[model samples]
Target: MVEGNNSEATKFILLGLIQSPELQALLFGIFLVIYLINVIGNLGLIILIYIISLLHTPMYFFLSNPAFVDLCYTSSVTPNTLVNFLQEVKRIALPACATQLCCFIIFVVCEVYMLSVMTNDRYAAISNPLLYTVIMNRRVCIQMVVSTYLYGFSVGLLQTMLTFHLSFCIINHFCDDIPLVGLACHKTHYKDIKEVILFTLAGFNTLFSLFIILISYIFIVFAILRINSAEGRQKAFSTCASHLTSITIFYGIIIFMYMQPKTRHSLNTDKIASVFYIVVPPRLNPLIYSLRNPEVKNALKRIIEKVFSTVK
Candidate 1:
C-alpha cells in the first residue's frame, strides 16, 4: 500500500480531451485534420510572403510574424496532444511539460504584441499616409519584432522559474508525479501567487495591446467618416476589416480563457480555448488576409504562376 497525503496522487491521467472512447477517436481525427491544415496554411503564408515582392509592406511584415508565431504556437501543443490521444499512456516528462508551458506562453505573448504592432502600422498608413514610410521605417519595424520576442521570452522565463520552484511529494501511482505539475502538488503557497501573476501578465498584455488597437481604429474610423466620398470610407473600413476580424477572434478567446476566476479551472475548457489560439488562428489567418487583402491575393497568384511556369 502506498502511504502519502491524498494530494500525492503522483500521476494524474489526462482523460485525453474526452472520456468516451468513440468520442476520443473522432475528436482525434478532427484535430489531426485541423492541425494539418494549420501547419500548411501558416507555412504557405510565410512562403508566400517571402517570395512575393509585392507583399513587402509593413502590414504584411507584421502578418508574417503572426503566421510564424502560429506555427510555433500550434506545434508546441497539438503534436503532443495528438500523441496523447493515440497512446494508452498520456504522460509528459516534467522537463517537457515545463518547456511546453514556457514556449506556449512565449508565443502567445509575442502574438499579442505583434497584433498591436500591426495595428500601429495600419494607423500610420491610414491616419498619416504622408509619413507612413518615414514613421514605420525598416529599423523601427525590426525593433518592434525584436521587442515583442524579447518581452515574451522574459515573461515566460519569469513564470517558468516561479512555477517549477514548488515541491511535489511522491505517491503510489504508475505514472510519474513530476510530469504532471498541475496534478502532482498536494499544496503549495506559490500556486495561487503564480496563477495571479500569470493572469495579471496575460491581462495586461492583452488588454494593453487591445487598447492600442481600439484607439488606433477609433481614429481611423473618424478619419474615414470625415471623408466626403463614400468610396474613401469603404476603402478605409475594408483595409481594417481583416485585422479587426483577427483581433476579435484572438482577444475574444483570450479574455474568455484568462479573465475568469481561478476556481473556474477546467481542463476541457482550457483545452478548447487553447485550440482557438493554437489551431484556429493559424488555419484562419492566411484565409482571412488572402480573402480580404488584394495585395496578398495578387502576390499568391503571381507566385503560383511562376512556380507552374518553372515546372513546365
Candidate 2:
C-alpha cells in the first residue's frame, strides 16, 4: 500500500529469523525478556534524567537522547519480531513494513550521531572541565540535539524514498534495508543503482560518524594522560568508560553487519548479526551506564528511598 508507482507487493512475508518452530518458540521467550528489559531500562533512564536535577548536566542530557532513541528503535522492530515467532506466515502490510524501515533508518541515524555528540560532550567535560559549563550551555546542547534529529529525519526520508521505489514482488526476510534489497524482485531498471546508492549512504554515514568518534576519543585520551594525579586520571577515564564500551559493542556489530557488499552478505549470518545489533545495544546501554556510573546509581538510590518513605 505504499503510495508509489514502483511498489507491486501489498504485503511482505517476513521469514522471521528462522523456520524452526522449536527454535522460534525458544527465541520468542528469550526476546520477550530482552524486549522487556530494553523497555524498562531505557524508559527508566529517561525518566530518571528528567526528574533528577543532579543529572541535569550536559552529559546526562546527551545520555537521555540515546535512551529515548533506543526505546523507540527497539520498539519499532522487537514486538513484530516477537509476534513472528508465534505464527508460521509472518506477513506484514506493506505500509507497516515501510514504516518499520523508515523508523529504523531514522533512529539508527540518530543513534550514530547521538553517540558522536556524547563523545564530544565527554571531550568537553574531560578536556576542559573549567569551561565545560560554558562550552556545553543549555542552548548549545539543545541545538546539537536538534541538529542531530534534523539530519536523521532528512536521511530517513531520503532513504525511504529510494527504497520504496523497488517493486518487491517477493520478500523473504524482515523489513530491514539489507534483506529487502537482497530479496527484492529486481526486475526494475533502477534496481542496481538504487542498491548501490543505499549501501553507499549506509557506508558513508558509518565512516563519517566513526571518524568523529575516533578523533574525539583521541583528544580525550591525550587530555586524560596529562592529568597528574592517578585518581584524577581514573575519574576521567571512568566518565568515558561506559560510553566507550557501548560504542565498541555498537560499532563492532554495525560494521560487521552493514559494511559488506550485498553479494558477500549471507542472509542467515546477517540475521544473527541483526539480532545482536538490534537487541544487545539497547539492553546493555542502560545496564552499562547504571551499573558503572556513580551518578545514575546515586540518583536511583535516592528515588527508591523517597518512594519507600512515601509508601510507609
Candidate 3:
C-alpha cells in the first residue's frame, strides 16, 4: 500500500479469471480460440465490405466501423488476459492499465453509438425506401461515422484523465471502471468524483444511444406493418434482422454488467460478463451479419468462388 506525493500505485496485480492450474490451462485454450475467431471474423468482415462493391451502401458502411472497433476492442484486452492466465503473478503497470482502460472506453463508446446510428439507418431505409439513398447520402454517412469516433475518443480521454489521478491501494480483475473504483483507496473527494464521472458518462452513453435505438425501432416496426404485401414486410424486416440481433446481445450484456447496483456485483461474475461483451460479441457479430444479411452472404460466396477458381 505504498503512495507517493503525486503518484498512485505504480503497478497493480490482476487476479485473472480462475485460480486452479488445471482450469487455467483449459480456459486459456478456450479463450485463445475465442480471441482468434474474434480477430479473423472481424477482419474478414472489414475486408469483405471493402472489396465487395455490392456492400457499399450506408448499412454496410456503418457496419464496417463496428467490425474495426471490435477487432481493436478485443485485442486490447484478450491477449493480455491470455498471457495472464499462464503467468504466476499477473501484474500490470499503471501506464499499461491506463492504456487498456483508455482503449476500452474508446471502443465501448464507439460501439454504443454505432449501434444507434445503424438502427437509424435501418429506420431511414425501411420507413422511406424510396428516399433511403438521399437520406443516407455519402456526406451524411461520413459525418455520422466521424462523429461516433470523435465522441468515443473524447469520452475516453476525459474518463482516463479522471481515473488515473486517484491512488489505488490494490487492483484485481480486468481493467474496467467499476472494479477499479472499488479497489481505489478511500480518498473522499477523488473517489466520489470518479464514481460520479463513471455513472454520468456510462449512463449517458448507454441511455442516450439506447433511446435513439428504441425510437428508431418503434418507427421501423410501424413502417413494416404499413407495407401492404407480406413479401414487402418480410423484405423490410430482413434488412434489419442482423442489426437487431447485434443490438440485443450487446446492450443486454452491457446493462447486466454496469447498470446494476454495486452491492449486486461480484468480481467473478463481472469477469465472466466481461468475456461475453469483450470477446464473444466480436466473434458473434460477423457471423450474425454475414449469416443473416443476404448481401454479405452473396459477396462472400462470390469471393470464395473466385479464390477457388484462382487456385485451380
- Tell me the TM-score of each prediction against the true structure: 0.88, 0.94, 0.95
Per residue, candidate 2 scores C-alpha lDDT tens digits across 60-160 of 99999999999998999899999888988788988898898899889999999999999999999998999999999999999999999999988888888
Better of 2 and 3 by TM-score: 3
Taking all chains together, the TM-score of candidate 3 against the true structure is: 0.95
Models, CA RMSD each: 4.1, 2.4, 1.6
Give candidate 1's root-mean-square deviation (CA, Å): 4.1
**Residue-level lDDT tens digits of model 1 in 1-312:** 122654422332444556576877887898899999988888999888887777787778888999999899888878878877777756665566668778888888898988888988888888777888889999999999999999999987887777666554431111211222344354666666766677788789988999988888888887777778888778888999998898888888888878777677665566566566666777888789889988888887787898899999
User: CA shift at 68, candidate 1, in angstroms?
Assistant: 0.7
Question: Candidate 3: misplaced stretches above 4 Å?
Answer: 4-8
Alpha carbon deviation, residue 188, candidate 1 (Å): 3.1
Displacement of residue 31 (Cα, Å) in model 1 is: 1.7
Candidate No. with top TM-score: 3
